[model samples]
Target: MATSNGFGPRALRYLESARNLVGCAGGAVGLGLHFAGLGGVWWPGVVAGLYGVGALLTPAPKPRPPLPPRPEPRPEPQPLPPEVSAPPAPKPEPVPAPEPAPAPDPELVALAAYLDTVPLPPSAGVDGLLAALRAAGPGPVAERIVRHRLPVAVAGYLRARTWQPWAGPDDPDPAVQLGREVDRLAGELA
Candidate 1:
């Protein structure tokens, strides 16, 4: 009729039954594995290991002792001396600001200008655009064009590119695929 700590006797009994069931299940599994030539003679050891771990984990009960009353310690007293204060020091001067960064390369500047001049339109069919990109030659610009058409073309490309999953958009951890999708979506939407 009595309870200890947080759990009642019924709960404790249920826990014991569950633990016994788990132990039996583990032993049966180990035995089966051993007979199947998977676990070998180590099956008994495995069972014993599980039981040992369970026994070590099981909580033991102890009687609660009475709490002792608290007594505060007395505070120490301080002696006063003659008052003598020193003057504060002067503040330091401000630091010099950093210089501006150098200009970008002329080739990079020209490329940026050229890219700016290029008209980006959603109505441009992906196939025609991709063909144009391929014809333009192999470079970052061509890669950028393919990246732009990814949302419309990537899924089909990926499916055909492999027998197994080619790290498609539907995949759980498709970081590169997701980036490509975003870039294409942004390009089309823009």
Candidate 2:
């Protein structure tokens, strides 16, 4: 593996060969100088000189470059369907300002009061409640309550009432369901 710290195999081999050649030349020069009346001290100087030349000839290892910068990840824009992009339906026109919710009718109040006084079962079926409401002259309110409130109120009252009256396996008690239903519809009228 290539390393930043030093030369690899090829550079090492070249350096080794160059060092050996320089040492051989130094030995040859020292032998020649000794034969030519140069002393042992002169031979050491020749070897030192050859070593200096070898040091200069050896190449410097190149510096490794820094790693490249990492690329930034782009956020993927989701494609919205046409229906989702249609400006949120203009917030439903502010629900027509709710028309101020009409005040509860006096007749509805009296009817609701009357129903509250009556003792009725929590699990009364919707039909029997409608029948009782019809007998009480709230035929229209009875119809409305049965349509919207009866089922919801009966379910709620059955949940809250301590008395487990009139709820049966076959059929729920209609009279009590009618009373609870009337109470719920009256709340809307209020």
Candidate 3:
């Protein structure tokens, strides 16, 4: 048909059927390209373009006399979905920051490091304090024991001995106390 656009029927049909841009299977290729485009991939679009595949062009509408406007229809109200009506999830509580570990006692740490090498009674057996010191390292527990507790224990032992030097069987032996201390320190350190 001779129209203002100047495209003959064959040309118009060709424009509408740009699917055959590459040749056969243009529609299938174009569909694949469309899906790829939706998925943020562009290689399919390139392939489609190379194969001469594209969106089908819509023909221009034929001119006609205008008609009177129709009355507006009211839209039906839809009920909210159960999910939409459900309460929102509660926000997670903020995690508390962990407290920093206290510092080790410098004097006790040095003393512990040296204690293992120091000479002791033959009964002490392989120096538990040294093994414990090595195992536990000069950490906070060791520091606390040596700095705050050990001296007090030692002083109390010495005071008891000074007041009552009877060499009695009931009195705590230094060697025995050393072994016990080793076991206790090892447990504490562990």
Q: Candidate 2, which ten residues in sequence have the lowest lDDT sum?
A: 122-131
Cα lDDT of model 2 by residue, 48-138, tens digit: 6766676557565566899999999989988788877656554555445555644544554554555466555545433344445545543
| Each prediction's whole-model lDDT (CA) | 0.53, 0.58, 0.59
lDDT by residue for model 3 (77-165), tens: 78779878867789999999898664554675665565546555556443555445555656688777666555554455445556655
Evaluated against the true structure, the overall lDDT of model 3 is: 0.59
- Model 3 per-residue lDDT at 112: 59
Ranking by TM-score: 3, 2, 1
Q: Which of the numbered candidates is closest to the native, going by highest lDDT? A: 3
Candidate 3 runs further than 4 Å off? 1-105, 112-119, 153-164
Kindly give the stretch of ten consecutive residues in candidate 3 with the minimal lDDT sum: 52-61
Taking all chains together, the TM-score of candidate 3 against the true structure is: 0.32
Which tens-of-lDDT digit does each residue in 1-190 have in candidate 1? 6556556766776556646556566667667777888766677797676665654554654558978878888787554444644455778887888875544434434443543454433343434444344445455655554444443444543444453365567554333444455456445443
Clashing pairs in 2: 124-173, 124-174, 125-173, 125-174
lDDT pick, better of 2 and 3: 3
